[model samples]
Target chain A: MAAAAERRPVWMRAMIYGFVATWFILAAFPFIWTVWGSFKVELDFFSIADWTYALTGERTKAEYGSAFTDAGYRGAWIQEEFYRNFFNTAIVCFFVVCTSLTIGTLGGYALSRSSYNYTFWLLITALIFRAMPPVTLVAGYLLPFFQWNLWGHLATTIIVLVAINQPFTLWMLHSFFKKIPQELDESAKVDGCTQFQAFRHVIIPVMWPGVITTGLFSFLLAYNDFVVTSMLLEEKNRTMVPQIAAFLGTTYTEGNVMFAVAAVVSATVPLFILVMFFQRQIVSGLTAGAVKG
Target chain B: MKHRTFFWFFLPTAIAMLLFIAAPIVSVLIQSVFAPHEAVLIEVENCTPLVGCTTETMIDQEATRDLREAQPLGRFVGLDIYLDRAHLAIEEVGQIWSTSETWGSFWSRIFNLPFYRAMSFTLTYTFVVTPALIVLGLMIALAVNSLHRHLKGLMIFFSLLPMIVTPIIGSLILFWMVDSRGVLGSALVSLAGDPNFSLKASTGLTWVMLIIYGIWSSAPFAFVVFYAGLQTLPRDTLEAAQIDGATRWQQVRYVIIPHLTPLVTFVALIQLMDNFRVLEPIIGFNASAHATSLSWIILNDLGGETRQLSSASANSVLTLIGVAILLSPVLVRTWQDFKRKT
Candidate 1:
C-alpha cells in the first residue's frame, strides 16, 4: 500500500518474487499434499517402499484396488462415531457464539456509551483474563464441575468456553462499539425511545459486523479447543479436535494411522472454508485489535 | 449511558466472568494450598496362630470415608504442595545445585524435576519462537505487499488457513508430513544421508519441529497485522526518503520498520502470551516425551487417573503468576494509555 512508483532494479524485484514464491510453496504444500494423500491407502500415504508411491498412489491402487478409498473417513466417521463429535462441536460452537454475543454486545455497548471509571477496570480485567492460559483455568473448573456432576456434558463445556471467550469478545466488541458514532443512538433517545429500545432499534442493525467478527472467534475457540473440551467433556461427548487427538492414541497402534490422517484433513475443511470466505474480515479484525490498542 | 443502563447492560457479562473466570482464579488459589486427605490407619493385633503376636496396620475405611466426605476440597496444607518437587521443588533444586560439579550438570539435574523441565521449555520456546516468528512475519508481509494485486488475495487466503485451522489439527497435518516415511521427514532423512533419521526419536529435532509449527501457525497473524500497518504508512515519508537518496534497504530500515514498530510490539506481546502455553502441539505431535510445556504439565496432572487437583492447582497458580509477569509490561503500558485517555 505504500508508494511503489520509485522503480526498483530487476534483481531486487526478482529476489522479492523468489522469496514469496518459495514461501507460498512451503505454506501451501503440506495441506495440498495431505488432502491429496488422504484419498490414498495407508501404505501409499506413508510409503516405506518408495516415497514416490505417496505421490503416484501406486500402493493405494495395489492395496485398496482403487486409486481412492473412503476407508479412513468411514473408519473415523462410522466405526469411531466421529459424527457425534462433529455434532457436539456444532452444538457447542452455536451456543457459545450466541451466548457470548448476546452478553458481549450489551456490555460492549454500555462500555462505549458510558463515561464511568469502572469501564476501564472492566476492560483491564478482561485483558488479564485473556492472557491467562485456558488450561490453568481448567484445573479450577474440574473440582466444581465434578462436584456438580456437570463435567461430561456439552452444556457445561459451552458455558465454560463462553466464559473463556468473553474477555476477547468484550474487548473486540468494545473497540467495535467505540468506532460507531455515538450520535446515532443519541438521536434515537431524543426521538423518545428508551435506552433498551434505542439499542434494539438503532445499534442492533449496525452491530452485525463486529458481532460476526467476534462470533467467528467464539466459534473457533469452542470448536478448536482441546484442553477444556478434552478435560471437561466425557469420552462419549468428544468434539472434533479432541476426537482427532484420540484418533492418534488409538488408531496409530492399530495401524489405522491413515484414519487419523483422514480425520485431520476432515477437521481442516471447515477452517479452510472459513478462511476462504472470511479472510478480509479476519484480517481487518486482527489489525483492528492492534490499531485500537 | 446512565448508571442504571450501564449496570443492567454490564450485569450478564460481569456475572459470567465472575462465576467462570474470577471465581476459578480464587478456586485455583485456594486449591493450590490444600493437599488431599490421607486415609485413616488403624493398628490391629494379629492373634492367629501363624501371625503370632505380630501387629498390622490397616486402612480405616469407615473413618477415612467419613473424613473424605467431610472435607472433599482436601485438607489445607498451606504452602506445602507448592514447595514440593512438582512446583518450586525447593529441596531438590537445592540438592542439585549443591551436588552438581558444574553449571551444565546442574541444569541437567534441575530439569529432571517436571516443574523445572516444563518451565525451562516454556521459557525457551517463548524467547526463541517470538522473535523468529516476528522476523519471519515481517519478511512475509514485505514480500506479499510487493506482489501483484491479483495474487495478494489468493496468497492471503492460503496463508489464513494455517492460522485459522485448529492448532492440534494444523500440527497434526505437519506431523504426518514429517512422519519418518512421510514427505518432509523423508526429505530430511535423504538430505542427511541417514535412513534412520526420524523426528520421533530425537528431542532436539522435535523441539525444532514444534518451533517451526509455531511460526507456521502464528506468522499469518503477524503478517496480517504488519500488512494492515503497512497500508497506514505515510507515503510522504517514503517520497522524502527517495528524494534523499535512500536505498531500498535504507527505505525499509529507516522508514518502513520504524513505522511498523508499534505493530511489532503488538504482535510480540500477543505471541509471548501464546508461546508461553504451547500445549496442543505437544499432544498433536505426540512429542510430550521430547518436550513438555507448563500447560502440558498441568494437563498431565489433571488428565491422570488420580486427578492430582492440588498439584494441578499449584501448577495453575504458578502458571497464572508467570502469565502476570509476562503481562505486566503490556498491562503497565495499557494502564498508562488508559490514564491518558481518562
Candidate 2:
C-alpha cells in the first residue's frame, strides 16, 4: 500500500496518461459530436464549406435564427411519427425482459441446483444456441411466422427476442444461482418446505441482484436488436433501431439526414443513462463468465 | 433437484428454446435444400394479326399458386440452391479453379463471387478484430489500472460509451463523421492531398474503417473483463517479483499476462463468435458495396422487394457451419471438462 511500491517512472506514467486520454477521445468524441450536431441543420452538421461550421452551426442559425434548433427532433418525433416506434420499442423491451427473466430464473435455478448429467447437456445446448448469430434464425422464422400468421406483430417479435435471449440469461443466472450457497435452499426444504416453496421463500428474495443485472442485458438485447425486430415487425410496428434504419433509406433522398442523426442520438440516450446507473452491474456481469471460466 | 421438479422448472424455457432456437435451425436446414417453386410454365400458341402461331411460354399463375399452396415449403431443390451461383457456386468455383493460371488470379476470380467475398471479409474481420481488440483492451486496462483512483471511474465511464451504445447507432455516429462532407472525411481528403479521396469508395479503406469500428465498439468488453481480472491479481507475487529486481515490463510480461491467460482465452472465444457476425456496421457505414459478412448477405436476401427465403436460408446454414467451425475448439474443451468431471 506504500507510495514507493505503487510508484512508476515519470515517462511511463506520462505514457499511460497519454494513452488513456487518446482512448477517451476515440471512445467518447463520436457520440458527443453526433449529439451536438443533431440539433443543427444538415448543411451545418455535414458542412462541406468548413468542418468548423458543425461546431458553430452557422447554417442552423441562419435558418432558425438560433445556434441550436429542434428541427431534427421535431421532424423525427412529430413529422415522421417516431413516437410510435418509441412506444413499440418500449412495449417490446418491457414484455421481452419480463418474460425472459421469469423463465430464465426458473431454468437457471434448476440448472444450478441439479447434479444430473442432463444439466450439463442443457447448459451446453444453451451455449451452442448463444453462439448462433440471431440473423441466421430470421430466415427460418420468416416462413413459419408468415404461414402461422405470427409475422408482423409485436407479440411474435417479443417472444422471439425472449427466446433468443434465453441462453445468455440462463448462463448468467445459473452462475449467479450457483454462488448462493445450496445450504440456504436445502435448509429451507428441511423446514417442511417443498422445492417450489423453498425457492419462493429462500431464492427469490436473494436473487434480485442477479436478476436485475440479467434484466439489464435482456433489455439491451431487445432494445438493441435490429435483425429480428426489423425482419419480423411490420413497418408500422418497427422499433427505434429499424425506424432509424428506415429513416436512412428515405432521409438521404429527401435531404432529411438530420432526422436520422437526431434519431440516432435519441436512441443512444437511454443506453447512456443505463450505463451511468448500472456501470457496476454491467461490468460485473461482463466479467462474471470470464473470471469464473 | 429431482427430475420431476427440474422438469417443471425448466419446461417454459425449454419450450421457448425449442420453438424459437432449435426449431429455426431445422427450418433453415430444410429451407436451404428447397428453392421457391418455379413458375409453372406452359406453351401456348397465339394467332395474332402480325404473327401467326408463334409458340411462347407463360407462367400459369393459377397452377403455380395451387402448387405452392399444396407444398408451402417450395420445390425441393436438394442442395441446388446451396451450389448455385449466388451461394456456394460450386460450378463457378470449379471453372475458376481449372481456368486460372495462378493462385492470385484464382483468388481474385473467387473473390468476385458473392459468397466467397462475404466469407473472406467475415473470416478476416473475425480473426483480425478479435486479436486486435484483445491487445488494445489489455493496453487500456493496464494504463487505467495505474491511474489515480478518482480518475479511473471517469475514464471507465467514457470508455464504455462506444460499447454500450447500439451497434448500428454507434456505427452511424462514426459513419456520419467519416462522410465526404463531414469532419474526418475532409481531414482525410486534405491529408491525402486529393479532393476525391473517400473512405467509402475504396474496398481496402472500407474494410479498415469497419475493422476499426469493430475494435472500438468491442474493446471495452475486453477491457472490462481484463480490468476485473487485474483486480484479482495476487499482490504477493508482484511484490516478490519487485524484490527480485524485476523491471516493470517483466512484471507485466511475466506475472500479469500469465495470470490473465485464461481470461484471454475467454475473451478470444467470445469475441471470435461476436465478430464473425459483423452485420450492423456494414449496414450503418453503407459499406455493403465494398464489403459484406455472412450475416449481411442473409440480411440482404431477406430484405427489399424480393425475399429470397431459400437463398437466405442456405446462407444461414453456411454461416452456422462457420460458427460451428469457429466454436469447435471451445466445444471440445467443454466436452473434455465434462468428461473429467463425470
Candidate 3:
C-alpha cells in the first residue's frame, strides 16, 4: 500500500510539472510567435500553402530573397511616422509619472499620517473613481477640452491622464507610507524639521520601494491607454497604441498588417524589459493592493 | 501631521479628483437626462414666376445656427433615452416575452437588442472569468509553491507576461494566431476536415475564444496573489494534520484552502471589476459581429464621425449603475469591516 501510494505521487508530481510547463508556454508563446512572425512577409506569415512558411520564411525568401526582413519596421517607423507617435507616448508617460507621483506622494503622505474623519471619505471618494472606467471620464473632458481649446495637445492628454491616475497612485503610495514606523518621521519633526522637511528628509529615503512600484503602475497606465488617448487626441497628435489602432482601421484594406505587427512589437519591448528588471516589485505591488489598498 | 500642514499636502490631488473624476460622473448623469438640441428648421415664403406664390420650406440657416449656439445643452428628454429601444428596451422585452413561442427563443430574441446583448456578454464574462481564473490561479499557486525555490522565480517570470502586456496588443497577438490563415486556425481547419471552417463565422466559437483570452490574461494575477498567501500558511497546522494520518487531499482541503480563502476573495473581487470592462479584445479580434460588450457599445457610439454623445452618455450612466450594483456588496462589506475595526 505504501509503495502504491508512492507510485501515485510520482505521476502526480509529473502531472504538476506538466501543467506548470504547459501554462508557462501558453502565457509566453503568443509574444514570441508574434515577434518572430513580424519579421516575415505577409504571405509567409499567413501562408495558405503551409504553416511551415511562417517558420522557414519560404515566401519571405521569394520576396526579399532572405529569411528575414525589416520592411515592416521601416514601414511602421518611418513611412508611417510611428516615431512621432512613439515620441508623443514617451512624453505622455514621463510627465504623467512625474506629475501623478509628485502630487500622489504629498497627498498619500498626508492621508497616511492624518488621524482625521475626512481622510476616510476622501479615500472612499478616490476608490469610487478608481473603480470607474476611464472612458466615462473622457466623455466629460471632451466638451470642456474642446471649449477651452485644449483637446489634442500632449499637455492636455498628460494633465487628463495624471488626474485619472492620481487616485490609484495616492491610494498605493498612502499604504506604502503607512509601513514606515511613525516614530522615524515624528522624531525628525520633533528635532525641528517641519512636516514638509520630515517628508523631504526622513520619509523620502525609506519610501523608494513603494514609490517605485506605484510609479511602475502609473507608467503602465499612461503607456497602455487606448480609449482616452485615441478619443481625445486628433489624427496628428495620436500616441503609439492609438496609431497602431489607426493602422488597423486603414491598413486592413491596404493589407499592411505587418506595419501594425511591427509597431506592436516595438511598443511591447519596453514593457518586457520593465517586467524583466522589476518582477519582484511588480508582484509585490499587485498583491499589496489585494491585501489592503 | 498637523491638520494645517496636511491640508496643503492634500490640496492638489483633492482639486484633481473633484474636477475630473467627481465632476465627470455628475456630467454623465446630467447628459443622460438631457438630449442634444434637434437641428432647427424654419420656413420661407417664395414667390417665383414658375411656381407662383409657393411657400418653400427653406432652412433659416442663420436663425437655426443661432438657436444651436444659444442653447448647446439641448432639450431635456428626461428618461426617454434610458427607456428607449437603444437602451433599456423595456417595450421590446415585454413584447418578446409575450410573443416568443419557446424559452430559448425568448432569451435569444431579448439578447438581440443591443443593450441586453452587451449586458448579457458583460455579465457572462465577469461571472465566468472570475471563478475560472480563481480556480486556475489556486492550482498554479499550489503547484509552484511545491517547486524548488530557484525554479519558482523563473516560473513566475514567465507567468507575468500575459498580464503585463497591453490588453489590445496581447489580444492582437492571440488574434493573429487564430486568424483563419494562421497556424492555429489552419490546424483547426484540418481537424474539422472542412476548409470553410472559421471561428469568425460562428458566434459560439468566438465567445469561447474570448473567454479563453480572458482566462489566459488574468490567471497570473490570481496566481501571484495566492502564491504569496501560500508562503505564509502555518506549517504547524500541516504537521498536525500529517501526524493525524490525514491524506494529502484532506490536508489541502482543510488547512491550505482555508488559509487561502481571503486571497481568493481579493482576486475574485478584482477580476470581477476588470473583466466587466472587456472592450479591447472585441476591437482587436474584430469580433463585434459575434459579440458585443457594454463598454464596446459605448465605444461604438463614441468612435465614428457621428460622435453621438447623448446615446454614449446614457450607456455610460447605465454601465456605471451596473458596476455600482455589482460592487455594492464589496463596498458594504468594507464598510462593515471598517466599523468593526474602529
TM-score of each: 0.98, 0.98, 0.97
True contacts kept of each: 0.80, 0.83, 0.67
RMSD per prediction, one decimal?
Answer: 1.5, 1.3, 2.3
TM-score of model 2 (CA atoms): 0.98
Residue B98's C-alpha lDDT in candidate 3?
A: 93
Relative to the unseen true structure, what is the C-alpha lDDT of residue B143 in candidate 2, on a scale of 0 to 100? 88
The pairs that clash in candidate 2 are none
- Tell me which residue pairs clash in candidate 1: none
TM-score, cand. 3 vs. native:
0.97
Residue B342's lDDT within candidate 2 is: 81
lDDT per model vs. reference: 0.89, 0.93, 0.88
Candidates ranked by TM-score, best first? 2, 1, 3
Error of 2 at B11 (Å): 0.4
lDDT of 1 by residue, A1-293 (tens): 42472366778788888988888887898899999899888888887888898878897788778788888889888888888988998899899999999998999899999988988888889988989999998888988887888889899888999899999999899999999999999999999999999999999999899888888888888888999899988889888888887878788789998788888888888888888788878888888789963
TM-score of chain B taken alone, candidate 2: 0.97
Error of 1 at B294 (Å): 0.3
Clashes of 1: 0
